[model samples]
Target: MVDQSAPLPSVCDLAIWEPVLRLTPEDGTERGAGRSARVAGRISPSGYSIAHRGSMPSTARIAVQDIQRELARGGVREVVFRAEVRPDGLTTLGLVWPSPAVEPAYGSVNLGVLVLADGSLPAPWLRRPDPVPGAVPAPSADPELLERTLRERLPDAVGATEEEIAAAEARLGVTLSDELRVLYRVAGGDWADDVETAIRVDKAVGCEIFGVEHLFGIDAASRFPGWDLGATDAIRTPPDAVVQGLAGSPGWIGFGTNGGDVFAVDLTPGPRGHFGQIVLLGHTESLGAEPVADSLTDFVLGRLREERPDRRGAELPAVAGVGTGRLASVQAAAHPALEVLSLDGGDGPPFHLAPVAGLPRLRTLTAMPGALADPLEVAGLTALEFLALGVQEWRVLLDAGAVPRTLKAAAVTVRHQDHLPVVPVANEILALWDRPRIAQTLLEGDLGPAAAPA
Candidate 1:
């Protein structure tokens, strides 16, 4: 007999116990050889009570089925039994095994079950409480430093007041992003200093910030040819009305220019469109626009600190009667790394180009509507590989036998007034070489067969 009052050991402290049903005849027959004794006991949380007749089966499966049937009658959904061998050669039964559905107990505090020495079972253990989740914080934006930087750089800069900016937003029918609004309030659309004039025109052509006048007003649409501001219903005729209208409705708001090139704010948002971004459009029609800066403030700050080419050291020898002396001086000072030179005689009087020594890297030369009396002046440039000139100068060089031997390619352009067929001239140049690489440009009409294969 076991003591029932001695404070039962915690469920975790107790060893697993298996209950066995032994049979004995009423007439004092040997225990396992005769009729079996009926077993009656609860299966803890399963509330099962076993009651069997006759002799207990030697097979483990028969015994397990007996236990399962008893568990099912007590409303238990599942039952797992383990058989333990006793000294009498009979197997004892153990209740519920550890599984995913059964949560582990916390030491002695909530061990899932208690088995008595006599195989009587107690109540099941309680479960642990679930944990609470944590809260996530929001992101923060930059402070007033960005706006302060813009003010410090452009001291004479004029910024749009809150009312003016709001009015513009109302008129444009689009909400300006926080970054853009901050930019307008710090520095509106203009620089008081000679910012445009200070930019190097020759080095950075077709890329300059616009003045206040070009930035504001309903007539601003006129500054950008082929651009239709239909969103604002502001359209104006371009100076050269012959050019076709630009493709696609204007998706950007124009703010600056590099000569004829445009810089604008991209308003469309998507994978391809960088909304609230600034972009630079190249002067060449073939080149597509490119993103320059993330915002207007960044673009302006970059321009203010941009470095111009150093032109103070160089000097060109004065050549009397040749009107190119000043032009040569300016060109030398402006482009120190120039390898290709393009000149237009229409910009000034006809001038003789003196052989500019020390230009060891000069290779390609293009002259438009110019009277180059002696093409031999450039014969000394051993590196010269390509030459482009007006039809008159090309003919002059062909007659004088002064075309440089180093020349591998040559292009000719025919003016509208010359009324010369481009093919004939192109063929003449091609005839000069057994395998000539030639290109021709027609100022007005098309260059039929003479057009170079792309």
Candidate 2:
């Protein structure tokens, strides 16, 4: 019998070992039983905890049994078990398997076996770093100078009154971070050009900050009716899969848009929720609400200093000002190593695809639906591996063999007013792929993959 009076061992005290499935002759005889499955474990203050990743109830039970048998075989004794009911009503069993070989040291004992009982695992398991507390930004050397510089650099800079700021907070249901509130009081919300650009904080991760009009509660009036502000849908990721953040959340309050992309702040506070932190709700090829910055101040300052055009190579100047005219002048001075590029023409004008012919190392290109109308222009991009184009352009590219043979994947966006026949176009694209490929099509509101031909 175990001593119930003694405190439980901490996870750090144990030599955490992954649970590997071991199949004996008897286990092998069981239908659907295969070689051992490896379940990763994390260290907590109490003990090491292992959670089933999307395993079915039946499968989870088997895994737990396998782990217990393996431990017993290893000479662990006096194992205790407990079942925990999750909020969703699923029962997850927790085990306390002790290792007698390893003696206790530093007031900590060996935590041989432990399992997560109730709550979901922390988001850090997805490899997202914990939010580092950021210091308040001071753009210039002097505080007064920083204010003056901000006013001069940011066109249409206006300060909000204390009463106005308070009102906005009350309506939003979350207190704005002090640094962000100061920004609103100093420079107001909108910028002059209103050019939407992503502030890259991590690789393939960025935050798209919109113009001033979307700031504060300005967009609430213009928000789409389908946009739900209270939905807290957890992201569906495979157990062992690593991603940025959750996908759907009612806690996300939209503040701006980057083209069709929505940028919002997570108001819900907890392990998964970055309460008061700015998050980029997935809008394009990527999915999930990726936490961009610790606060609005971090995002704005990071955008101004780090994501500036000058910092990024001049090979792609079109990113600085995203317009059809700006894109036309973006010529690669040499055989540039530009891999990913997104061209947004907005409502201004259509982008000229002539400059892209110079990029020999271009891999992925995401542009306005109408930008790739002329398939011949992009056919010469032999290095192009992935392309995001409209359904009409997919037809044109397929018919003309304009899609590079090097292209391994593609995504087509179907517009609301698009009346073009999709079945034939989808068929043609599928026929062109000789090997295994990934082909996705964005229909009306769904950004899922279109079924491939058998």
Q: After superposition, how far is residue 284 of candidate 1 from its true place, in Å?
A: 2.9
Q: Candidate 1 at residue 24, lDDT?
A: 17
Tell me, what's the RMSD of every candidate? 42.1, 24.1
Q: After superposition, how far is residue 410 of candidate 2 from its true place, in Å?
A: 0.4
434 in model 1: Cα distance from truth in Å?
A: 52
Model 1 spans with C-alpha error above 4 angstroms: 1-145, 189-250, 269-273, 286-288, 297-454
For candidate 2, lDDT tens digit of each residue in 1-454?
2222222332111112212121111322221232222222322323323333343345544544554454445544333232222222222223333322211111121121111111112211122223324323223223344354455555444566777677767766556655445555665543344333122211112344433234542122122111111011112322222222343334455665555767665554224333456665445322244555555544554542222111112434212233554533335322354545566656655555666675765555656566553656776566665565676677677777676666544445434313224333543554565322212121111111222223
Clashes of 2: 4
Query: Candidate 2's error at 333, in angstroms?
Result: 9.7
* Model 2 pairs in collision: 21-36, 190-212, 230-250, 231-250
| TM-score for each candidate, following the candidate numbering | 0.26, 0.27
After TM-score superposition, the amount by which residue 118's alpha carbon in candidate 1 deviates from its true location, in angstroms, is 99
Candidate topping TM-score: 2
**Highest lDDT against the true fold, candidate:** 2
TM-score (C-alpha, index-matched) for candidate 2: 0.27
